[model samples]
Target: MKILDRYLLKTYLITFISVFVILFFIFILQTVWLFISELAGKDLDLMMVIKFLLFASPKLIPMVLPLTVLLSSIMTFGDLAENYEFAAMKSAGVSFQRTLRPLGVFILLLSLCSFFFANNVIPYAEYKFINFRKNIAQVKPALAIAEGQFSDIGSINIKVDKKSGDKGEFLTGVTIHKKSSLGEGAKTVIRSKKGHLISSEDSDLLQLVLMDGYYYEDITPKNYKDREKMPFAKAFFKKYNINIDLSKLNAKEGEDDEITNTHSMLKISDLKYTVDSLTTDYNKEVISVADNLYQRLGVTNYYQVDSINPKKPKTPELTSFLNNKDKFRVLDVASSDALSSKQNLEMNELNFRAKKKDINSHWYSIYEKFIVAYACIFMFFIGAPLGAIIRKGGLGLPIVFAMLIFISFHFLNTFGKKFSQESGITPFLGACLSSIILTPLAIYLTKVAINDNGGVNFDFITEPFRKISNFFLKFNKQQ
Candidate 1:
């Protein structure tokens, strides 16, 4: 690289690093602040929040990359223009595209990095982040039991009167109250002299080892006033398995083993496989779904109808309904043609449904991520050229403009994606939205920048207009 090119590249790199760091801090700080109320009384420690923010970093990277480019590009070129480096470079027989070579190289490298981040790293981070939250929630399930606090585990709330970790377990004087949507008003209250928690291997059921307890089983009768309440004198259990299913424990593991596992949070490869599968399934449905309809109605189409000849005026041999024999023959021929056409219409309707499902399916989560990443490329070109045109590199004006432009782009893409999810729009259109909208604008701006007519004049334009307007106003005042 030439010395001038090296200098420009160095400045660009420095600007990128500084801006990215700032953007990361700003984004994460805002997210953490929003959870201030939620985190107020929680047992969340430093390492936990740190872990959360660390896992959250991947989610922020894609969002910040475009902003980083916008800020850094504006700063870098604004510096070049301020120092007259660009003018010197222009005078020295360097073309506009040549000057942009370093920028192009940097953007291409960044795009590859962004793509990898979006595909593998970001997806895995999202997967792990969700798992991390679930695991954290399940932590200290004993400490989760507060004094007089009805702690919920599935449909069961257990409050402990007293706790003792004497035996190196979750020992407690436990009172349990459980309810379910599918249950009667059967209240089972158990008070144990001592109890502890134990988890069965590979199963979600937790074994509550209760010893020396009184059991009260309250059952509501068919009549509310005639309730049945039974109290047991004493209970002694060395060990007992609490037959409770951990519905919360069904939290999705960070694995793409099934399609349900990757409903929304999916990677590129996973989405491709799913979309391909959906397409194939839809095609197969189009072929065999007519059979489902046919089977329901007991209507069999041995062969597809080629055509019905309405033009042929053929008379029927059997004519009994009409007094006129000619009318009976015409009616018979018309009915035969109508029957063939109806069969063909039914087949077309079946095909249309199958085709519609294929066209309007929700793109796998991975596909959505790919769309976001591809949109960044258009954002890159747009940001760079816009910064050059506006010539406002400071955070105040530039940040506002950059954010407005990119946020609109982002929102539109999201809007389209949501519409696609609802089957209101095609996935292909949703995926390529930013590219479709911004590519032409980028090309136009690039052409303007190259020809030195970047939509506005720097010295010769605004100043002259101001002077001419002042002159006309002064003449009007004198008259």
Candidate 2:
């Protein structure tokens, strides 16, 4: 290898590694802060906490790696330009393109690595991370009850305004909703001024003791006409004890083997399989709904009538078909059928929309794997040329430029994904939106760098205004 090539590669690698570590650390801290509530009072051991963070950290790579590439490219090239090393290289007959050759090869390899990581490691980590959370909640039922949010532990949904104690055993302003066995929803509501949670590792029950509470149970009347009254029984109590069964809350052995079916947890091959199945199911459902609605509305009877008599009207008016009394009866029955069909169609439309969104989500996930890989190369082009043109390096200006560019990219990416998920656009377009929007900028920067333009020219914009001002000024002077 030539000395210049080696030198450039070395400088870039050093900067890349340094930037990656710092950024990764910062993101990990952010992750910790984001999930602090889930981890704070859960009494998780050190190993479990580390495992949680470890599983989550892989997901950050798609965010961190591209930014690292951009920042490092800008910093490396910017520093060289600021130090006049680029001038020396230019004088020595080394072109700017030649300087980028070595690092470009490295970036190509890194992109492949990024693709592999996204396709395999990230999905696996997502699966494990999700399962870990579920296991934690099951193993420690107390962790399920977070303060200020309703938490479903088994059949009961419990909410607490405040919790204080060594293990958050003391609760204040407790509200409990017990779901009925008949699937009638939460018919029984319990409100308490204070409550205490008691549980043991060896036992299969969590005991909740409420003090100064009110119990309200909704009563369903036998007569359908009286149901509108919404009668309920209420009673005040000084003390109440409830035993919540924890048999199912105990984490069974090999529970993680049950795969999580979320799109994020699927690799490319799995995603393709899922998308195909979901699409097939969606098409079948649409066909079934259409056929059912066709039958329900009696459209076939009209066709049959037309087949029997060619002269019969295919769509007869209401008055032409029957006498006054018979017409009224038919109209009432038709109205009822139409109303029922409308409701059915509306419900099916919502289901179809939801299913389509799910399919789109899977498609987006597939595209995202490739997107992360390509983003590395994309950011590098933008960063390397931008740094050369700006002639600034280090943490000050490069950081600002990197952040603005990356923030724009991230925003467009998020918007596109969300919009695509809602079926506003195709998944492919959504995944590639940021890249499409920024391609021209990368090209412009590279062109300016190669042509020695120093920076973007504002002459066209300024010269027009200048000429206008001069024309006005000359007219005024002549007058």
TM-score of each: 0.68, 0.76
lDDT of each: 0.64, 0.86
User: What RMSD, rounded to one decimal, does every model reach?
Assistant: 9.7, 9.0
Cα lDDT, model 1, residue 435: 67
Clashes of 1: 0
What is the per-residue lDDT of model 2 for residues 1-479, given as tens digits with 9 covering 90 to 100? 98888999999999999999999999999999977766886567798899999999999999999999999999999999999999999999999898889999999999999999999999999998876776564455566687788977678899999888766788999999999999989999999999988886666678899999999999999999999999999999999999987644433345433333489899999999999999988877876776666667777655432121323327655577578899889889999999999998899889888889889999999999999999999899999988887787999678978998999999999999999999999999999999999988888888898878666753564477678889999999999
lDDT of 1 by residue, 1-479 (tens): 88877886888888889989999999998867854533444455788778877876787876788778866776666666656667787899887678788878878877877878787887787777666654553453343445556666666677776655532246567777667365764366676767776653455455567777776655446776555444334455555556555435333334323223454456666767777777777666555654554444333443232222113333435655567777877778778866866887688777666555444544625455665556556666666666666665656445765676778777876777667755676777776676688778778766776777756544554467568889999999999
Model 1, residue pairs in steric clash = none
What 10-residue stretch in candidate 1 is worst by lDDT?
302-311
Superposition TM-score, candidate 2 onto the true structure: 0.76
Residue 465 displacement (Å), model 1: 22
Error of 2 at 351 (Å): 0.4
Best by lDDT: 2
- What TM-score quantifies how close candidate 1 is to the native fold? 0.68
